[model samples]
Target: MKFVNSLLGLSLLLAASSQAHALSRNAGQTNQSAQQESPDSPRPILLNYTLLKTIDLATLSQNLASFGIKARNGVSIYKVSYATESLDDTSLNASGIIIIPDTKAAVFPWVSIQHGTIIAKAEAPSVAPFEGLAEASQGFVAVAADYIGYGDSAALPHPYIIAKGYQKPLVDLLRAARELANQKDFDLGPLFLKGYSEGGYATLALQKALETDYSTEFSIVASAPSAGPYNVELTGVLNVEKPVVNPVNLPFVVLAYNYWLADGQLALNDIFLPAVATVEDALSGAYNSDQVFAILPSTASGLFQSAFVADFTSDQPTLPTSRDLRALLRTQTLLDGWIPKAPTRFYHCIDDNEIPVAVTEQAVATFKAAGAPSISSVLIPSPTTGQPYLHGNCPAIFSPLQWFGEILSGKAAQ
Candidate 1:
């Protein structure tokens, strides 16, 4: 996890260019003045390329303000529309909000963002605490996909982990950002991907797909995936007894099973029992986070002998039981499949009760073994004293200042 001093080279380039352009322009002006024989006759001196290219910071700030973001101390914050190609047969007419810096028009860089589960558009404004947008405004073009059914679109059963469906939204969003950059006033630069919680899983999926499918169009500068369950089955086992576990995660397993099973990979009947089926039906309509958590266990318990114990048994033939499931899920599928084509920064709080820190730590190990360009894992302090009470403080844990400085300075590993 070493960050190279590449920003030094960039700084030198900017300084040298400015000095050379200034000297060249001054010399040309002096020659033009001398050529004017008459005091009344004046010749126009040609300006240097650097002067022509110079950006008026004040003007830029004014333009950025129109987009509901403020620029201060050389950083511009703004939200703009970014078009994305739809994967579900609908041609065109799809877009999302991309928060980026006004200065990125000069040095374009890419940053892909993924949101967590059950949270949609209105929820997003609260989720990351505006850090994602700030990241973009600081110097990166940060793109966040509303995941097909969240933002301005229909809220049908969100296909949680159906790989093709999930990845398409993200990839299309990235494509949209690139397309926007090609416009007269945009600068699309090198790309990076970041996500938290369920988004971590989506980010990994996009990274894998990009390396395998879209390498030519996009290059991954770095990726930060935090607190995602790479292994679906393992997640189920880990949450069996945890009171915080809810139906929000249930859809993911169902979706995964539906996807794989539809591909003839596994039979649903063989993997799940009648009780699990009833539980799934009851939990499907649960909307907000509170309802999902409050009703899931009771509904599931009514269907099965015990909501936690009955669903996972040692005798299950095809699908692994709770014990074996934990081992299987603990394995990092996302890290196992994708070769890190760029640097990666993985962060997870040691006190994360929802997604176990052990899972994230394992992922870090997996990426390291794969010879990832840069894999940095940060362990933030626990907010609680005991019993692991603190929740929903990821933004504070992974400070925006540190994240932005690392990426903007090109000190990010991978």
Candidate 2:
């Protein structure tokens, strides 16, 4: 069987936009705490922000024109560093990018974009131009987070697919964005969330966190979680066991879980074949996805030990490592509780090779069964190929930003 390189052209396929309005640097505008604070209360999440750079209208337009996107407004990109708790309640400084429109407004709607799986640190929003640029140019205060493994937290292993762990950076980034807006005198209107691939999972996770814990502090207008593995216990864990296109992700997730959840108890030799077990060099921020892909087996399961494979495939795993993995994957599953209250849409290509469409279909069914208020799924087919839309190719065809724009303009059902 031939292995498909599903990670091809990912950087170009996932290109994004961002920027904020130019306001006077007022002394009072800096981040500050309330007059009175409970002794036990934590400090503010938004520590401080630095204006990284600004892109004028012409520059933004010229850059976007290559992708057939128009830039209506210039953008200012700011690198936001904030404090957030890690998996073990350790205080960590994480970073992300916030792109605000150049034009002044009393208020702007916030669109937080959770990026998909990124290998290199350079792919992080703070370092490179990815998805939120077009959004900022469209007049939305766009933000994208550099997950724990990237940006300020680059030294640490990313908590890949860990629902609770990944949501912190995203949640804190939104808090930072809101605080930044507040300091500028203007305010943010409705809140919107959008993400694809791993981001799609993060989107649902973030939404669940906000609706469950931060309801008073924030309200979601809508969410578009595209091509995410919400059913981690069933679909997510099983997908990698097969002949997957992007095999490198298997090690990525395993290494992350080992560090964050398993206390690094699972050794490289136990999880992977000796030939490919040494992945630290490739997974480090220095190497790109293509480089990582080159080192791993074409199929994820090919990298695993036969004993591990047998245990994973069995109905009841005898191996302690396999059992530990199942337990960890179960914790990340999102199909069970907390039906989304706000309008929600799950997008996917019916024939996605990386993350199967069944993942989204099953999630929608579960949400409906749980009496979700507003839930729908958009299954898009490849316009060019007329066949399967590989995971890397789906974003270019379906438009989350356009769907979000429709909702903001009151042109789409909310």
Candidate 3:
């Protein structure tokens, strides 16, 4: 198979938006029927893998304290390109990063990582991977998808919260990464999943997609999705409209989603005010997530129309426009609790201001209600003050290492 030579775009390092301070970080479908893939769906095929960088053991150990990632020896990082169909079935190339521990182990335990929300194409795994890259140091083959709009496919519109956002590229990347690992003479063993924020939501989506649609093809030994807005309809869309949400998510989700899925079907005015509607196109990738906040109003009241904002604050959404948003939210919620074949744990910080911890709690409760005893949760307290950890700080705190290390350690032993 042919491949792109320069993997993970070395230039992506400078444009990596995930570096805007640590701490960070989708829902769609009925949680089951939504995963049924057409037998003729685009099968993921590995096109190529390009060597990016080598993380030596000493370098890994030196950075261990700052990032909490510990490495035994050196590791090889590769930029990968694979064939995947777009939302409408147009063939497209997706990019991701794959890291292999430079060890002599006969079999490699693998983990697939999903990145949190990023607006710039440079913010992807090949270029940025941000926290997802941390897992690479932990003596495993760590993989992450750039999704559709980043990396090689940067020109494409980022689908944001859509189901296929994670389902398609993530699975395809996992399969392609496995193929590359095999070709390179690495044995594959246990597979696990971990992600936070947008990555967290996508993590759940990927887990369910694999379990429900590709059960015969793959299995996750365990999964941990932290601080994702699982209840999208209520906690995300509905909650963000309350006028206090960080403000950027409203325009980011509302505009990008309609652009990718309902661009022609819904008018800009249908979703935002005339001011916002006129500039909705800018929300696409023309601006990075941070840029979106700068260009758009910083407060929900300033960003949305008065009527729509009023409706969101009311007892129940009554306006046709308000109802339309709710419908969209229902299409993406993850709180339905699809049972996982393996042990799954949800994580969140109680002090999180971005995504309420209640959403994770709700997901755990739903799983328990469905008799999924293997499903549980862990609340990571603010390590410093022992108080609540807000959004941005959590990513730095979680640091992508040891977050899953202890739990996965136990599972690996069993």
Which scores better on lDDT, 1 or 3?
A: 3
170 Cα displacement, candidate 3 (Å): 1.2
Question: Which tens-of-lDDT digit does each residue in 77-190 have in candidate 3?
Answer: 667888887888788888888888888678877888877777666556776644444566666688888888888898877777777776877888888877887777777787
TM-score of every candidate relative to the true structure: 0.65, 0.87, 0.83
Please give the lDDT score at residue 115 for candidate 2.
85
Question: Tens-digit lDDT track for model 1 on 314-373?
Answer: 335233333433343434356566767666667777767667777778777887888876
Write down the lDDT of every candidate, Cα atoms only. Answer: 0.52, 0.77, 0.68
Q: What ranking emerges by TM-score with the best candidate at the front?
A: 2, 3, 1
- Distance from true location, Cα of 295 in model 3, Å: 2.2
The 10-residue segment of model 1 with minimum total lDDT is: 44-53
- Best candidate, lDDT: 2
Q: What TM-score does structure 3 among the candidates reach?
A: 0.83
**Please, what are the lDDT tens digits per residue for candidate 2 over residues 97-146?**
88899889889988988888888887787766555887888899998899
Count clashes in each candidate, considering only residues at least 3 apart in sequence or on different chains: 7, 15, 7
Off by over 4 Å in 2: 1-42, 275-277, 384-388, 396-398
Clashing pairs in 3: 8-126, 23-392, 23-395, 23-396, 27-332, 28-331, 28-332
Worst 10 residues of 2 by lDDT: 1-10
Candidate 3 local Cα displacement, residue 320, angstroms: 1.7
